[model samples]
Target chain A: MKGPRLTEIVAGLPAIVPFVGPETQERQRGRPFRARLGANENVFGPSPAAVEAMARAARDAWMYGDPECHDLRAAIASQHGVAPENVLVGEGIDGILGLAVRLVVAPGDPVVTSLGGYPTLNYHVAGHGGRLVQVPYRDDHEDPEALVAAAWEHGARLVYLANPDNPMGTWHDAATIGRMIAELPEDVLFLLDEAYVEFAPAGAVPAIDISDPRVLRLRTFSKAHGMAGARIGYALGAADVIAAFDRIRNHFGVSRIAQAGALAALGDRASLDRVVKEVAAARDAIARIARQNGLTPVPSATNFVAIDCGGDGDFARRVLAELIARDIFVRMPSVAPLDRCIRISCGRAEDLELLARALPDALAAARA
Target chain B: MKGPRLTEIVAGLPAIVPFVGPETQERQRGRPFRARLGANENVFGPSPAAVEAMARAARDAWMYGDPECHDLRAAIASQHGVAPENVLVGEGIDGILGLAVRLVVAPGDPVVTSLGGYPTLNYHVAGHGGRLVQVPYRDDHEDPEALVAAAWEHGARLVYLANPDNPMGTWHDAATIGRMIAELPEDVLFLLDEAYVEFAPAGAVPAIDISDPRVLRLRTFSKAHGMAGARIGYALGAADVIAAFDRIRNHFGVSRIAQAGALAALGDRASLDRVVKEVAAARDAIARIARQNGLTPVPSATNFVAIDCGGDGDFARRVLAELIARDIFVRMPSVAPLDRCIRISCGRAEDLELLARALPDALAAARA
Candidate 1:
């Protein structure tokens, strides 16, 4: 018997989740991980004020949240030094990426990104039937020059680049990024994912004209603000491009609790400063631990550090497997050069202690 | 020089929001509504257990929610006596609706629904470039027979029918709905949006096999569970249809706090029973209040009652405006015969008392 048919685009797509969450791993192993340092989640947690705000909002969860995300957008706009019309708040960076892709890419349209860059963005692109042209990273960092060249080659309408790039925690300074922005093809839309920018050094995020319609800046509270579970993120772009999201976004997608929590967290500069300093210490400790284990740790501009496993991708894979078996959750990149290193998130001392204890044994086991 | 181009379809569709929320109205008026009986929200609020669970989850908002939605989906499966694979949870009914449409609708594909049924349903169809074929309601209820016939005529891939219908608060019995289902063409997928099913009568929902690929059922915690702001909803469909959602859905779209709140809300059956009973009482009270004000209250199975304003659609519109001016936030349908009535949601005594006190004045102002 015939049933309703799936659109050819969706039918052609494979059902896959870009990231395998740590919880799924725990379920398979029948136990919790000893150190939850994967997924770049902040271990220190959101501010007490943010938590309190969420609790307060929980009592009033009967009414639907403001579809316009009024107060939250106003606050975000003020912080960004742009008009509220220039901002678009959504479920998270993931949701905003999906909408951005939907707005610009049609079937058979070309889209470009680094080969092993954020898989979620690639997923959104592929889900929309966009042809993906993946350029390999240069010098272990997402190469802006290569991305621009690929976009021009493919006549790509979209290109995704993350500042303080994931998996390898590398970054380009503001002046370097400014030159990249200036060099971008006028017809291409740059999807600038700055999800980890808060942890990067000052000026890693180049100042770009918000009125310029070519680039969309994506930022999330999930990283430095320590509220990943809340799924709060926003996009800053030209007012018209921002307005385009209104045409297709699930307007009430953000939970009221998330809105209130993000708003509160944004106001708590002290908490942000504390988390940044704590993350820095944790990063340094992680580097020292890597050196003690005879692995070279890559200098990081984000909350996570990538450690060169002193071997190939396969060897790094084995090391990751050993870590997982020992209940120390860590992840590595999905592609060649980047995959030669295993990435670990900055964690509290207790969590790092677990990681430290497990690493030597994990390394021995992987070698065997 | 051109800067980023929008795809033809997105560029072509009108940028519009399906509903103007009451918050927007409040902002425009520069004052809050004294009585918020609009939007069909359960003003009594979520259970204490749910609020507590959400508050607890707030502390752990640093980690992302499980992409699989494991425990929450299992809990929902247990409640429905279906396998977890049969259920797909999303941001809300609106979110689920959008995904469902995206899966089945290609550009210019035909979809059938009642005229002025659910604007959001139409919005999703339009967003996905689906051609909407609207059949007029049969005697103020969603005309399933007409919808099916239209689907067959249009060779529609999808049909949306909201049982315990919105705007009119009317529904067909199980036997009638079963006939509607039986008559559906094999190629047409029936989208049964049972958002208000909890408030519907015992036999209002027809028995349909869970294995049936011909239909998918949507439900929400927004109404009976009083968690609209939490944004929790689910769809039960054939395994394949449910599985298809995985290919394109935002895996981590639902927030962890929402997941916790929904799980706790589902376990609190006492709260559900209490709310159902309270809603029924409120419906009766609304009818009595309508009679007291010399208006006709339509028989309701849903949480809200539709009051016939004793004149035309324009009269009803004027009365609704007057109620708004008096700070009584109530809504009326947007289309012809349906617009001849104003809808009032279930509210606590204080809220309804505000409505009760304001109705006569609103009506008098309308007449004057």
Candidate 2:
């Protein structure tokens, strides 16, 4: 029988997964990692209140979640000092990115981003048949000027930048990003991914300007709120742009447990502050470990630190493999230059202790 | 400033939401409903084991869920006697349907469905710019022959049917549906939504045939498994067809709690059977109430029943409005003939008792 014919766009696209979860590796290795320090997940965990809310909501799982996500959006808006209409809650920033791309990008449209930035955004671009124009990083930081130049040159529909960038753990301060946004073509949408903003210093984040129709800022409970597994995130943008999400998004996509958990997570300021502090300490510990091993650690504003392996991408991969062999979970960037470093998420004390023990042996094995 | 330019397709698309959630109505009305039955959620609730699993997983919300959904898919496959590759887990049936439409329906592509069928599927097709060719339901049941005929007539890329249909709660036996499937065009992908299948009779569901490349059967934790708020569902299809989901789906869309909960729900057959029994009893009770109010209840295989209001669509609308004013949340079909009935989900005894009391007054209000 002739099967269903895939659309030209889908049929021509490569079967690519942006990131492989740590669980896949655990299954393949036939053992669990001693330290789960990959994926940049806040190992300090979600607020007690959030967990409590989720547990309580579980019994009510028989009801479909509010398709409008009214309360969650309202809470997010109030916190951000915006109207509820300005916020759109989704499964995560990843899901929201997909919808944003769908809203603006057509087949063959150009989308600009850092060369080795968040691959999930790139994956969404590819899925929608958008052409990517990648700007190489400058000194391990996403080059805002270069990205803006590319967006202008390509007449890009969407331009994405992760503040306090991933993998390299490098960031540009608010003024640089704000200037970049101003330089972009008026028609080009700027996606400001603040997934790590809560962990960054005050100067690192730009003040919210809801009046900018071309800019959409995405934040998530997945980071400092320590609720990555809950799969909830929100985008703050112009009301018109935010409302566009309802036109195409799966309305009931966000789970009821997630809505309740995120609302509670937002209300619990103590937990957020505590997780941020723990992450800061873990980052320092990771850097110290890197220095002891004769490696350089990138100054990070995010929860994860990138430790230069003092070698090339190949050598870093070897070190990563050796760490995996020793039941340590870690990751590295995929592009050149930055790929010389291995990225490790902030872990709990025991998790970092395991990493501390494994690093030297893994480095030795890689060198050998 | 021009701001971001939406794609021509998106710009041209209508701002249509498939369903207005009950939460939205509650907010507008300034009160909560006495009985929550509007969305066809299983009010008897999810399995206790499933709830327990979700609550336990709540603490682990720090980590991202498995993108491959290996364990859950393996379990689903094992139950259905198919390879793990044949099962694709997603956020929900609504989410999976969106991906399916994206895979097959390009701009201006034809899609076929019952006139008043699951509007969410229509929403997705519209979102993708697919041309919908809706065939009218015959005698309140989805006319399988007309749908198949429409596929042939329009050369449809996709065809959708909900077994034990929603809104009307009518169903076709396995043999009839199997024959309908056989008559479909070789290249037209068939989306058989058996969301409420657990409540269906023995012959209502066709035998699983995962080898069929064109048929993708959808099942959910939302109905008989009673985990609607968890937002987890699975699609069973040919391995190649199922694997195509990876090309465009939000890989991490499903929540970690939902995966664990659904896995536990699948394991707890006793709980599932018990829910089914309760649903059957509730269906009977709802039917008895309808009869007592001088209404004709449609024979239903799903967890909800559609009662003929003995009036036209306008009268049914008035009755629905009166019910809503009484703080009893219920919905009716949107298309004619079917719209002459009001749909009510099976609920707990107290919920039904409340509905029973409200019906006569609602009907009188409509009559007056």
Candidate 3:
């Protein structure tokens, strides 16, 4: 018997994840990875205060969390120097992206982004039937000027850009991004994803004008605060744009413990500072390992480093596979040129040591 | 300035929540709720093992949750004697409902349900631009025959039914629902939301056929498992129907801590049995309190009792307001006949005592 039909937009899409999760890989291998250097998760973990907060809040899991997310939003608003109405919090940045895309994009509308940018954003665009107009990265970086030009050419409603972008770990300073934002088309909403901004220099985040309806900036506790599994993120935009999320978001999406943990994590300044220092050290260690193995490490402004394999995308893919086979989890971009390098997240000493020892064997195997 | 244009359907809708949460009420009142007996949350709490599980998982908040939900799905399927492919877990039943509605009902598509059955389902339908063909309830119970007839008349693609219904706390025997499913329109899909069935009597949940694409059954860890704040739920359907969710769902929506807590809760059958017994006792106590206050308590199959005020809708609404004014959280249905009753959730002895002490004054004040 035939069941209910899917909407044309969703039906046309394939079931795919932006990145294959480490857990899925573990299942396939029938063993857990020794180092989870893929997915770019912070290995340093959340603030101890946050962990204690979640533990303390665990027993009250029977009651539904405040659907409004009032207190956390208030704290976030204060931190960003924006009113609470200018922000909307959701399950994660991924979830917030879905709402952002849905609010502005109609089926078949044009969206602009860099080729081989964050795949999750593209996934959201596809799910909403938004046609993505992709431009190639310039000099291993997302060229804001090229992106703005493409949006104008396509008459796109939305354009996505990540400061201190994923996979490549490259960034543009605040002044350059400000210039880019100024030149962007009036009708296009700039979806500024600052997921890795915490790892960048102080000038990397452009000054945000909350009243500018064309710019929507989203930040998360996931990257810098090291609470990816907690899945808490918020967006800052014009009040009208932010309020649009209420029309479709999961009202009770954020878990109660998550709220408590995030709130506590925000308050723990020492932990944030400590994590940043540790992440810098890990990045340096990964670079050293790359240099010792006769590879070039790309300069990075984020928690992960990209090491050039001195070969093509296919060669890099083999290296990634060999690394996985050696119980060292790593990833590479799906596009050409960029895929000549493998990406590795910052990890603790033990995890980094495992990667350091396994790299030579993985490289040799890949060459063979 | 008009920035990016909203998709036409989303632009036409108003921002709304299915129900105003208790926290929102507290925010308006400028105080904490004294007795949180409004939302039908299990006041007895989840198993200690579940709490411990969440606490332990809190330390590992750096890692993203398993996107496939492999282990949790395996557990749920094992419990129900279904294959893992037949089950799909999500943030909650509310989230799962949104996915279900999006999968089937396109813009302007007709959906069949009871007029005031579940506002959230209607909200989902509206969010997706689906029209609702709401059939009125028959004597405080969902009229399955009427719902099926409406679907057939409208040639609707989706039909929703909440077994051991909420707000009204009523149920239909398995055989009757089975008959209703048999008579449902050939191409129509039935969404069976058995959220409150754990508090229901034997034979209340109909036998589900996993191979039947026409019916998809959703259950939650919120009610019987007492983990609403955890935001965990699962849907059961034909493998293909279940797989359809992979196309659009937030891959890492569920938190790692939440997954651990739910898995532990599912394993604690003794705790579930205890909660069921306690809930029954609380229901009886609420009924007794209603009778003592010169109100008629409707017989209930779930964890709440609806008390008729022996007056019209406005009278019951006032009674609800007076309780809220006293910092006692109780909710009443919004529709006509249903609004003639004030619904109280099964709370602990202390919460119930607060309700008992406040009812007479609320009644008197509402009458005045």
Candidate 4:
């Protein structure tokens, strides 16, 4: 029954997935949900061109993708007016976060993130045997100042922040973020997850120099470009830091179809603009729905709204369970206080209608 | 200008990709190859059903794929006659190899593989700081007996063998492999890579015994299933060994579109059978062409044929270069003795015609 012993780090780790898929829940419930508004997926879908490109590339799936992600990186570079060396395209921001943690965090190394920020990042830190030092959120936003102070206090090797943050969907202005960047220890690497950046206001992303070497900015096709299923994302950083990925990454990990789809998605800025607008409108609709249900929806810069249920985590959990029971799929935060809010993604009008129908009943059921 | 220092292991490793992709080569040469018979890609492509499935899934690209890969695993398990709990699908066999190496190899741990076996596996071992103890191929095939000896001699944590191996298109029969497995150290994990198993002869795959904790079998949709670009592969092992992946894997790494395409691919056995027949014919055609050119084609048990170029490694390299120059993309091994052969994949009839026309000139160029 015994096999080769796993590395001490791996053996000590727990078998855990950061989030459970709605499909798994559906299987247990024995019925599919009418509204798929959880996971913050783009209900509007990817650009027509991207879809066509992936379809065409499907036949060529026999060939492995370019290990270097040449075409996609070239397109991203041209779009951002940076050298191709500045980018490292990976499976997704999630995958890149794992790789980044592997590169910098050795056993017992200190890493920092806001409490209840992104569990996946924390998951990676734990996987690598790093010691996680959490800075709690300020007003439901990742407190930049607290994170920097903790980095110095802990002599942390890495610090993570998600701009236009998930769960709470709050954001910090570019100037504030830049000042936070200025105060950070030069030895502490910053992971600026711009996963929701495209949906944020124009001035939200700091104009930091890529040559600074202290920061890695992660951008994904999952959000604005609506290619989450393609699993394509890139990190922008100093050339040396970027090149470090070549040493350890599964070189041919990115599939050929994903490369083609992401490249096409990057080229179609018009479609991205349209998605941003649609997401904004959907966010507004969700906020209104929350108000109608006697809950307060936190104003969102991202594609999802977090509705405070004005009670404990258990009440929010009940509301979420009731929503699911009524064929509406929604998620909530895992940690306390934040867990008092239920998270709903922006969806199509019909999907929102299903949510509207379910919300009041779910709230009443939870109250009962 | 400083960032967090990479861990001593990562900092000491070279920032290099094991293989330069064909696209990168094409970019460097400023022209695309006319016949891409390199990389052992299925030139005939995937099933129409799979293509259609991916096209349909493209519209749903906004959602993250089920992190568990539920449907695909169910389909694969049913096809393979194993429980879904015994299966662990990954980005590709390449990705799974990386994870396996990471699980077992700590700093300075010894691992064993053929001297010239899959470089990507070796790359993963080195990335995780595993000391690679290579046993050279005996004759043209990987010598399983030698590998077992190496494992015991080094007290290696893991041993890797590719049945119906890559680069050479050679194989060791199941009985031979099973006999060697019996002799392996009880505690040494065995990575049995069955990437080309579908193209292998009947009974080539050892009998499935999920209770054997020492062995993990890796199967890929990339090869025979023609979904390489979709990046789906699975590993089968004892429940405990299989479950270890959840401790460290990027949960949402696989794409929703990929999962859909792979599920469709698995359901269509007729398509797989057809591709197998085509692959056999293509292998025969390659062997015939090699004979006509006064070369010896190594006996193959896989989709590709390795043609002995009747010269040294340098001559084979020159021949490969000439074939690439003539737009008939082909590759050769990196090590001695094995490098005396040029590897060519099974392609469409038109592609073979191009190869036929180009081989003589390429041979002459190599001789010169």
Residue clash pairs of candidate 2? none
| Per-residue lDDT of model 2, residues A235-329, tens digit only | 99998888777788899899999999999999999989998999999999999999999999999999999999988999999999999999999
* TM-score versus the correct structure, for each prediction: 0.99, 0.99, 0.99, 0.98
lDDT (tens digit, per residue) of candidate 3 on A79-184: 8899999988889899999888888888889999999899889988998889989989988899999998898889999999999987799999999899988888
Which model, 3 or 4, shows the larger lDDT?
A: 4
lDDT of 3 by residue, B185-273 (tens): 76777999999988988889877788888899989988888889889999999988898888888898888988999899989999999
DockQ values, each candidate:
0.79, 0.83, 0.77, 0.79
- Residue A132 of candidate 3: its Cα lDDT? 89
Global lDDT for candidate 4? 0.90
Error of 1 at A202 (Å): 0.8
Residues A1-368, candidate 1: write the lDDT tens digits: 57778999999999655557899999999999989998999988999999999999999999998988899999999998999999899999999999999999999999999988999998899889999999999888999898888888889989899998987999999987788888888977899999999999987988858978998999999999999999889999998888888888887778888999999999999999999999999999999999999999998999999999999999999999999999988999999989999999999999999999999999999999
RMSD of each predicted structure: 1.1, 1.0, 1.1, 1.3
Give the per-residue Cα lDDT of candidate 4 at B51.
88
Docking class of 1: medium
Model 2 chain A — which ten-residue stretch has the worst lDDT? Answer: A12-21
Please report the candidate that would top lDDT against the real structure: 2
TM-score of 3: 0.99
If you superpose only chain B onto the true chain B, what TM-score does each candidate give? 0.98, 0.99, 0.98, 0.98
